[model samples]
Target chain A: MNAVRRRALLAVPVAAAVARDVAAQPAVEEDFAAAERAILAGRTPVAGGIAIDMPQLSENGNSVDLAIKVESAMTATDHVTAIHILAEKNPVPRVARFALSPRAGRAEVATRIRLATTQTILVLAETSTGQVHRASRDVIVILGACVDGG
Target chain B: MIGRPAAALLACAALGTLAAASEIRPSRDFLSPELRAQQDDPSRHPGWLWVEEGEALWRRGEASCQSCHGDIAGMAGVAARYPAVAADGVLLNLEGRIERCRTQHQAQRAFGYESEPLLSLTAAVALRSRGMPVSVAVDGPAAPFVEAGRRFYETRQGQLNLACTQCHDENAGRRLRGDVISNGLGTGYPAYRLEWNALGSLHRRLRACSLGVRATQFDFGSPEYLALELYLASRANGLPIEAPGLRR
Candidate 1:
């Protein structure tokens, strides 16, 4: 019994160390890749004309404010069609989708969302000309939200 | 909308002779410039989401709050006087009142404290009173609760052996570690806290403070929190309500 207890105590730290290592490893990037594929289809997105505003470090992940803007004249010929926000690791990566028309005057929208943990958020804007613009930001959340909301 | 000059005059008139004697500054004054700007701009403030959700819940729930209240316009300045002594003599804050109304009048299930729906409803109700003054009554039945809260604020507790007064009253405007401590006011609650990265209630912050002092933290809607809220409201008397306020 004494030997087993000693072994168990020694194994606990090792198990914890291994668990920490696994947690430290970056999550598979495939989740975002799949999400992007679904949104963009076969279109290759360029990383310009889209701006995302979010905090670099969030003390709480329950309601992080997100703002997205796309560079456009917002005229009949040139206007943003839609803006899609995605969280790389949330239970559902799709946070929100905003559709806009030229009447909106500016291609911008802001709202709050929940983040499950530290993850990259992608904001993609689709313009009338079939041009897809994308922006990504990494946010570190100290306490994740929506985990216990039943 | 009431113009600035007229509003100021009305405030003065309402405050009466002793208005100038109180140290009354909105919590916006205590925040950093960037945070203050965020609070001022509705587009940038995240608390609006809760308000929006709250507005929806008010109209659509099982027993909609709007059914009896009709348009919510008359609710203005109602939140500023909350944590008040109810007709039954029990001290109740906005959340408590919401629960009571749900159970008693609405004949519906009460939203648990700290739940999203509850927070949203509380924020919505409190938002109606935005820009009003903190004016909770500390007289009559509320007097005992106020005394209890005052004692809690002044008494030292926990491993740190520090009272709420030590930091909020005596060391206010001073730096502790990296953050500046302001006079612990309950105004601007149901506010978005950058540190919380979410909208939180006065009780949530009180629990945080209790934990900070290594003291016993109470449940969300506990009597301890109610008493503390009343005391904080008294401390913040005269400060304009900035519910759905942005805080860092």
Candidate 2:
């Protein structure tokens, strides 16, 4: 074979591997931006008194446990009413929404969620009052979400 | 160089160490303080979500488990003796037993492994045995099965060629990447793994390990997985059952 042809042939496998890697990481920016825009609308979320508990690194993204706790008195007033979990990179940014009441005793919610890729998880909480609080966690997912468990 | 009493004490200490070596502790011992606390709290435990669903399914189904086994309390301490030898000489874990009951007795479709319903039912059944000591039979007819399980544990597979013990036994309590590797135990199965974000069976966790090492994963409910489950249960023989465990 000609030298140039041989060189091109050798690069074929390398090119294919690079292509696969790029394909694995889909364009998450647009999804993230769209999700953020829809959720925020115009209200600026203040970051305070809300704790997001989750692993910094997730070995698998199919299921990742998350805990959200908002500081509240749990009285008739000054209580968290709803919490929204959004995964910036997931096909559907809105993962779960939990409604709470004073009867819940504590403004704490814990559950598992799916993450699509290595990205930030945004948690927004609304209190009985007009206050809005937000928190986000960056997770590195080794196995992206929505994989065939088989 | 030691005196007689000192030498005798030293001998006792050596014996204690040997005894401790044979004793197995629960996975709870290795959990981080925060995760351990979460597992202890019922309301906070994510696994309970499945357990609740399982309870509902048990009471509501046409062929309800309650019909055959009334007052779920009868199930107490049952999970502690799992991966037992069935009548046909097959070893069956708690999940396997649930599958059998569903197909044979209930005449209902068995829930898929790692599926929400299966996990919930398994968790509920296992919760009946919470705090009970693991005591699977490894003698008489059960001997060969336990031996098979031990052999699998020792055998290395996958491209990494790493045995279960290489990380879980030899390097337990140490970090493998960002997570701590606990001693391989089957006590807290139907566990809610933070990485899974859902309740999962011991088999799913084992399969994850197989994949992590680039080894071939055994199909769910496969004999190979059953053997490994038995081996792990045997290793955790004295540990308390902690089903519906929370793990990160």
Candidate 3:
């Protein structure tokens, strides 16, 4: 074969493989961005004064315990109004949203969530002053055995 | 310093005692520290969701579990003595007994095994017995059933041609893929399994194991599984029930 023709033939398979990998990339990023935009409503959240406490390594992706806290006095004038949880790579990035007020006594919430895979979990706490504080933690999820049984 | 033959004899003696000891450990002992912590924390444990559902079911109607049993706290230690022969002479596990109550006493249709409502009620009841040691009877009318169960445990089955004892008894604590092998104890039932993302009965877990070995998956509440449950409970005698347990 001619030199240019041989190189073109070899490049075809490599280009196809690369295309397949690109297609395999998580397509939910756009959905995640849209969901975040809906929650933030054009406000830019600063990353501080909020914390997410969760295991660094999760044994399974089915149920993961998560806890979130924000620094606030929880007063009527300066309280956390709502907390939004999002998993960047989940089919639906929005995991949960909790509405709170000064009556809640503390700016904290805890719950369990299902992780689709190893991904970053984002937490957003909106204060009464309309300021949004953000925090995120990456978790490594291990697939469980005997998953085919059911 | 010992001679070769004497050292070999000593090693055999040590193994013999280890087998005879048959030290029973709770399945939680085999969990990662994070999972173990999750199992212990009521707020964090996913099983509590089922427990809450169970409590709601307990008081749903006039012919409710609450009306008959009064306070749920009164059920403490009840699950520890289950898998017993009922007055009708049939062996029944906790789930089986719950099924009978739904049909016979309440005049309600069977919730069917492994249904969310049934699992919820069973988990609620089993929760009352948490921390209490298992004490199922293996003698009297239970003898034959226990014998059958023991036979099943010892005999090889399925395409894998492996018995329960082969992995659970001989190779427990060893790695099976990414997971650690557990002693196959049934103290935890109607427990929360992350793989299921819901609470499941011991029978469901057993059916999964059967499928894993390419064996015949038995029906829920089948006599064979009931007998095996009895045997497993007896094997776990004196081990605290960790029902609504957290498992991956």
Candidate 4:
């Protein structure tokens, strides 16, 4: 066979493998996309002014401590208005949403949440001036030994 | 060179000293620093969710725990001394005692084992005893039960043919897959286990261990587990209770 034809034949299998992988992407990814879109509400969220504090490795997916902080001036005119948490791979990607005001004094919240698997978590914060900021973190959740729930 | 008897005596003495030097460490010490910190902060601790439920349950109905016991804090040190022989001579762990109170005192139905209300109330009560040393009595009427528990701990059972001592005693502080094996102390139960994602009793944990070893899983409040709970508590004699503890 000609060298060009041989290379083209090899590329066909490689292309098929790539197509297979794209088709094999989990449905949860689409779930996350939809959830994120719902939260964004047609507005683009800029990546910054927000931070997520959580363990990089979680011993179990059951309950993980998470904290989100948004950089904002706590004033009536320039405060954080809301915070939304999204887990990219959880059955329900929307983890929580907290509505706040200048009365909150700070755009910080800490809580324990369940992660369905090892996945990226996104945090979005909305300011009083209609600006949206975002941050994300990846957590590796190890499966528990006794998950039979016996 | 020493005589045979003298050599045996020396060996025994060495073993005794080794046993004496094995300090009792809380399971929290085995957890990652992040989990350890989670256990300390109520706002960040999922166990507090159960404790909060327990607090509300404590005041529910006319025959509430608060109506009889006044402030729940008044029961401090009570959890630290559980798996004790009750007035009626029945050996009872904290959960058993709570169950008894609900049924006999409150004229209510049994909450059954591992029930949410039971776990909540047990955790709430145990939270009050946090930092107090576990002081379950292994003597008196509790003697036979404790002895049975010790036997259960030492005996090799299940398909794995492993005794509790094999791992928790001899191989503690070592890795068991992705997790570290902790010294088997019950001080931190009615703890919130990340595995269970909820607060659970030491009995539930014991049942999980039984299942892990492929042994006969006992009922939640079985006498066998009650005896085991007493023995474990006695072993933990002076370790501070970390009930509603966060555990992996």
User: In model 2 chain B, which range of ten residues has the least summed lDDT?
Assistant: B1-10
- Separately for all candidates shown, the number of backbone clashes (residues 3 or more apart, or on different chains) is 0, 2, 0, 0
lDDT-best of 3 and 4: 3
lDDT string, candidate 1, B53-167, tens digits: 9988889865688988876766898898888888898989999999999999988888898989999988898888888877777666777998899898889988879898888
Question: Per-residue lDDT tens digits of candidate 4, residues A25-107?
Answer: 45555588898888789998899998788989887665678988899988989999889999887666788999998999998
- Residue-level lDDT tens digits of model 3 in B23-104: 7578889989988887898978879999999889988999998888898888898888888898779998888888898889
DockQ of 1: 0.09
Stretches of candidate 4 off by over 4 Å are A1-29, A33-45, A74-77, A128-130, B1-21, B52-70, B87-89, B102-109
Give TM-score values for chain A, per-prediction: 0.74, 0.72, 0.78, 0.77
Displacement of the residue A49 alpha carbon in candidate 3, Å: 2.1
The candidate that achieves the highest DockQ relative to the unseen native structure:
3
Q: Candidate 1 or 3, higher lDDT?
A: 3
- Model 3: clashing residue pairs? none
List residue ranges in candidate 3 displaced over 4 A. Answer: A1-29, A33-45, A75-79, A128-131, B1-21, B44-46, B52-72, B102-109
lDDT of 2 by residue, B1-248 (tens): 11223323433656863364364557999876767887999977878998899888778777788988996778897888888888898888888888899999988788877778788888998999898877776565666776788788888988879898787777877775446677879788989876455788888878877766667889988888898887677667667899989876
Instruction: Assess candidate 3 and give its lDDT.
Output: 0.80
Candidate 4: TM of chain A? 0.77
Q: Evaluate model 4: give its lDDT.
A: 0.78
lDDT per prediction? 0.75, 0.74, 0.80, 0.78
Residue lDDT tens for model 3, A1-150: 011111211123345434433443454454777888888999999989987889998876667779999999999899999999999877668889999999999999998887767889999999999999989999987645444323
